[model samples]
Target: MAAPLAKEQILDTAEEVLRRFGLEKASVVDVARALGVSHGTLYRHFPSKSALREAVGERWLKRVSIPLAEIVKESGSSMEKLQKWFQTLIHTKRSKAIEDPELFSMYNALAEESVEGITAHINELIQQLTEIIEEGIRKNEFKRSDAGQVAAGIFYGTARFHHPALAKEWTSPNIDEEFRLVWNLLLSGLKF
Candidate 1:
């Protein structure tokens, strides 16, 4: 007979593996060995390494996604929504996942490579921002412009939308102040 792993324990082990070695090294055998669990035990819950990685990605979204949606939804204006999103990005930048330079670099590589649905993630962000901008345009609050281009510009400010660790230190101010300044300038250019 064998002991069972608590779901949390499995997830924690998976995250730790990803943090240290990233996707390539975060193999099933690696995670199982790291947790001192048998391969059979890990396979019982996660059929494969991709399955475990997906779970971790899902956890990452759970930690950051809803709050992001809420702030954008509740904002009094689209510009405010944009600003709030940037602020939230900063807070998430401090997350353990993002704090690890190697992990972050791995993410950057993935984003550029479109690995792990990385392009899908960026497309989602662009779509969300486009919707907000469209709403603002409808309300006569924003000048007519290409939402995709605007989204790309914001990406520039955030280091192609990578966040604090990925950005040049001189390219952006400290998070909150930097976001406020970014919104200030952006609004001036965007307002009707």
Candidate 2:
């Protein structure tokens, strides 16, 4: 008999199944079949199809957030860290959209279905941005302002480059130049 499937393994298989079948048609049974397990076995780990889908969405969001969190902890001036953070965020989103369009679509669909998970993911990102802004304030690198508000502004300000809904536009030749213009504008506002 095969070893009992780990939850992470189930999530991994489910992601693959979703990629193959697309979100609307990919059922819990599909993931179970992919894993060579009975659907009931997956139920032991994920409870329901919705629960499993939520876990997959949460996992995908974490893949993006975890790396950004590391950038937050790294040693750098606030300005440098903030630039790197945004660059990384744009690159991550762009690559996923360009390289794996189907999977990227699946992720967007999962995001729609998992509102609470998406909210938490957005909150975590804003909190990371807030930390960077607070550091800039402490070091006198940025003007004194509400860090959370500034963070949210910076996030929404750059949404054109990073937002999933705008993924198709990311492939434009001028997207990077446009981002630089926006970044410079935001930087001017942040500086003392």
Candidate 3:
């Protein structure tokens, strides 16, 4: 009898295969081969190729989300926390796009195809922002009728800075300066 393969091991190898061949060319067979397992073995873990791709996307997003979650939990003025959260998000997204472009592209392709995972991730991010906005309102630091709505607006308005598809524009020399301008606009509206 063979030992069971770890799901993380499969996902790690799958990510590598996806990075090497991309979403259009990669397959579960390639992942299984890379991991020294049969397609059947990998299927037991992932169910389907789309599922595997979604898992990879989810893993990458989770890495970005952890620090943002920490930022949300930290002791600080809501304004400070909001600024730091946006900065960290932009930094993380830009780092992923610039430092490991191939992997970033793979995730982007997978994300476009697999909306369920990415939608859930985006919602979680908005939820995090909503909590921060709510905190600000509670502390009398911000004036807004709806934290959820404001969070969604903030997330969408700042998409150019962090969205993978918009990464090309981020390479411009003045991206940071542009971000500050946007941040100030958002801050002014949030503050009483």
Highest-scoring model, lDDT: 2
lDDT of 2: 0.93
lDDT tens digits, residue span 106-191, model 1:
54443444344554565666666677777778777888888778776766656533453445442344655665666677778778
> Each candidate: what lDDT?
0.66, 0.93, 0.88
Candidate 3 RMSD to the real structure:
1.4
Off by over 4 Å in 3: none
User: In model 3, what lDDT does residue 26 have?
Assistant: 90
Candidate 1, residue 82: how far the Cα is off, in Å: 1.7
Off by over 4 Å in 1: 1-9, 18-27, 33-37, 44-47, 54-62, 94-116, 146-149, 160-165, 168-184
Candidate 2 lDDT over residue span 19-131, tens digit each? 88888899999998898889999999989999999899889999999999999999879999999999999999899999999889889888778888888998999999999
Candidate 1 structure, TM-score to reference: 0.65
lDDT of 3 by residue, 146-168 (tens): 99999999999999999888999
Candidate 2 TM-score versus the reference = 0.96
lDDT of 3: 0.88
Q: Supply candidate 2's per-residue lDDT for 140.
A: 98
